[model samples]
Target chain A: MQDLLFYFFAVLTLIFGFLVVVNPFTRSPVTSAMFLVLSIISMSGLFVMLHAFFLAAIQILVYSGAVIVLFLFVIMLMDLKEEARSTFQGIRLTFSLLLAGLFATVLIGVVLTSGLGAEPVVLTLEGSTAVLGERLFNAYIIPFEILSVLLLVGMVGVVLLSKKNLN
Target chain B: MVGLEHYLVVSILLFSIGALGVMLRRNLLVIYMGLEMMLNAANLALVAFSRFNDNINGQILVFFIITVAAAEVAVGLALIVALYRRRRTTDVRELTDLKL
Candidate 1:
């Protein structure tokens, strides 16, 4: 049962992720963004399968909920027209696809030959929310604080950049 | 039985797809989305390793990564919007002010 779920989510993640990148049926960025949301949701399902339940919830809450919504808002705000179908052509398209395929083949080959044994470790500690919260506030506290500061800077930078007339 | 290798393979494929999107697409927004996908791919790998290793640090790192990604998207989208206001196009090929 678990194996079947894993395969289902993995395939869905790959399919939707591919559509997010290259949907032959639609040239609209909105369509891509929606597909990305589907991809992210399926990925979170993988997270759940891994027993990182907290991360799975956070993935849905932050990624599919907040991040993709932001993407849609920007897409709508720009009112972008459908991209030209001829944008990708000739040598550039071939080169990029070739490069990406080469990258995948090399990485997968390395992974297969690395000889890492596949014995699933009995998880002594599940990534429950309470434990994650404790770790976040305890051992990882400094990085946690730094992340907040980084977010503050990002928010201020975004506001300044988006202003109508920045001198 | 899905093992560590299976998860890693999925991660590799997703990362490659993201890279393909980044290199092949013209729209800056789409490219940005591709970048997000790449980051998520890394996150997926980290989570898998964390699980198989019986470590919590990986999940903690993923939490930080998620926060950083949110910040990145906010700032990145704002920059794209500002650029569109001035340049009126999101196509990457045309925004070549730095081309010498």
Candidate 2:
């Protein structure tokens, strides 16, 4: 059952991710952003399969919900001129794809040799939001507070950057 | 019997595609989307490792990563928008004003 779910989402994620990257036609950022929503949702599903239920929820709520909406909002705000409507051609295309292929081959080789994933360590990690909350409020409290501040700074920076004719 | 290797393989494939986008595509927004994809690939690997190790720390790190990623997207999109407004183009190839 778990394997079935994993393969389903893994394939879905890769397809959507490919669509997001180099879909042949309509290289519109908006289209890619929409596909990205699907990809993120699939990744979130994978997280659920991992039994990190809270993280999965956060992934969907934060990534697919907030981040993708932000991406769409920006795509709409900018006057996108159907940017890069054509596919890559000639040497650059082959070169980039070759590089990507080389990278994948190397990475896969490393993973095959590492054997880190072969045997999963048996340990108890309760997949409960309550436990996560307790840790967030206790041991990881400082970093969590710091992240809030970072978000505040980001908000301020975005407002300042996007403002027109700021005196 | 899907294991950590499966997740890592998926992640590396996603990462490579993202790198291709960043390298081949001229449009800055597409490149930014690729960047997001790469970040997501990393996040997936982190979650998988956490799961395999049966540790909560990896998931905890993922939470922080999400928060930081949100901030990054907010600021990054703002910068992209501002750049487009100034130059009337999102093509990085043409935004070479700082060429030396």
Task: Find the candidate with the highest TM-score and give its number.
Answer: 1
* Model 2 misplaced regions, further than 4 Å: A84-87
Q: What is the TM-score of each candidate against the true structure?
A: 0.98, 0.95
Q: List the residue pairs that clash in candidate 2.
A: none
The lDDT for every candidate, in the order shown, is 0.93, 0.87
C-alpha DockQ for predicted model 2? 0.77
- Superposed by TM-score, candidate 2 places the C-alpha of residue A106 at a distance from the truth, in angstroms, of 1.0
Put down candidate 2 lDDT per residue, A69-157, tens digits, no spaces: 99888878877776544447789889999999999999999998998766656746765699789889999999999988899999999
Off by over 4 Å in 1: none
lDDT for each residue of candidate 1 in A1-167, tens digit (9 for 90 to 100): 99999999999999999998998889999989999999999999999999999999999999999999999999999878788898788998999999999999999999889865445566665889998999999998999999999999999999999999999
Docking class of 2: medium
The candidate 1 chain A region of ten consecutive residues with least summed lDDT is A116-125
> Candidate 1 lDDT, tens digit per residue, B1-100?
7878889999999999999999999999999989999999999999998988889999999999999999999999999999999999999989989999
